[model samples]
Target: MFPDTPVTSAALSVATRFCSPALLNHCVRSYLWGVMYGGAHGIAFDDELFCVAALLHDIGLTDAFDSHRLPFEDAGGRLAWVFAVAAGWPQERAARAHEIIVLHMRDDVPAADDPEAHLLQVATSWEVVGRHAEEFPARARADVLTRYPRLGFGAEFLGCFEDQARRKPDSAAAASVRRNVAGKIAANPLETHQG
Candidate 1:
């Protein structure tokens, strides 16, 4: 039940242009998981905003924006801000979208105050780290993975993170890379699936 608004379509198109198929699928799955998670938890959120945030959350990992000194999350949030403004979204909504992108990486996101941001954080974590699997329904998880196959996402995404760490040594990516690159790579949720 992803939003199909023009802005959502444009966001997806932009993401598809920049991201690999695996990353693109991850983005879509993040949105799906966010929506499902929110609905299951009775959290009211703006679906379009969540969709845009999810789709563009990893944009900085792409080649075009990867060169920036900012952490991938900040770079992606900036890019999302610009995209939202250009798409005629009001300043407040644009900022909210930006916040959602930027804060998705934090471990302690305040979900009660901003459900969209919370959902994005949880969804991204779930997609990347396989956390919170028990919170969501099994059927929804299967449906999402079926719709958006991992396609070796673990290797591809870890490679991207490693490259980011190499290029932006002072960034959060580098810190994460240094902390436990092998463990994180091995722990990727997509690595378990052969299909």
Candidate 2:
């Protein structure tokens, strides 16, 4: 479940249609990691709200990937906007989240100014690079490297994500997910798959 925020049912419906359960769950876990990292590093965000934001951040992936687009940055933002409205998130909040999601994939986005924004970027990057890197068709990887070199914390964030994923939501399924992701990234060409 997400935080007690007002998001439109229509938006939520669209989100459900767009994202697979596995990817959605992965985003949720990534958001959880961001919350943990914030506490560990003395950074704080509206954890509940951000968790909600991160959960729906990449709802656009279905369309982007379906269309066979080489780059996901712009598409991710557009997807966020579509779901933000459908889910009933406040206009301003959704807008901000959209911008952050778009910039989240880019290395040039000024990450130093806002901690929450930075957390979103860090969390999303970690989840993708760690769990989905190799599985992520080569074109997507190439797109990421070419379009978002500055927001390039993929390796470091994956390490942090794997460490965090090992804990929380104790269950065989959770552990399996962690192990699977760790294994995928471990042998990946990206950052030596250090996690």
Candidate 3:
């Protein structure tokens, strides 16, 4: 279950309504991974903000929110900003949520700079390409996968990125495609491992 808060609940509602089943599962798993990673690293975070940001980081990938020219992260970050403000969050707190979503797409974020962003970036990469995946216990990994199966997320996610690349040639998605993200997605342990 997600952190209990109006913003967190709203995030879940919006994500479930906009994201595909596969994408939604990925979003949820991202949060679980971050939680486990934080616990393992003894990194404390604001649970409600972290949970809301994690669930909405990929919102721009959805048909309802995708921007034609902006990178998905920027678009998603903007939407999350609006959502946070609407949920009665202070501007500074809402900005942190926006920052977390945008920063998750980065290659790395220093924990000292922003723990939530650092944790999310690491967690998303862990889910997408198995980066630092071994740090997580098998039991917890299996539990999360059981709760939210990949549901063909690898194939679906590749398609999404491919489309994003085609539509926005100068995007992070394009960079990912150039790096052969498809290969990484295929080789991710979660894709082949049977929990």
Best by lDDT: 3
For 40-61, candidate 3 gives per-residue lDDT tens digits of 8899898899999999999998
RMSD in angstroms between candidate 1 and the native structure over all alpha carbons: 2.1
Overall local distance difference test of candidate 1: 0.83
Top of the candidates by TM-score: 3
Better by lDDT, candidate 3 or 1: 3
Q: Rate the local accuracy (lDDT) of all candidates.
A: 0.83, 0.52, 0.89
Writing each residue's lDDT as its tens digit, candidate 2 over 30-104 gives 565566556656775665446555766655445433223323434556666666656676778767766766556
Candidate 1 runs further than 4 Å off: 188-190
For model 2, state the Cα shift of residue 119 in Å. 1.0
Cα deviation in Å at residue 112, candidate 3? Answer: 1.6
When sorted by TM-score, best at the front, the candidate numbers are 3, 1, 2
Q: Write the per-residue lDDT of candidate 1 for residues 1-195, one digit (tens) a residue.
A: 567699999999999999999999999988888888888888988889999999999998888876456889898998999999999999889998889888887655776888888999888777766678677666666667788988888778878888888878887667767878557557754456422
Which has the better TM-score: candidate 2, or candidate 3? 3
Give the per-residue Cα lDDT of candidate 2 at 84.
65
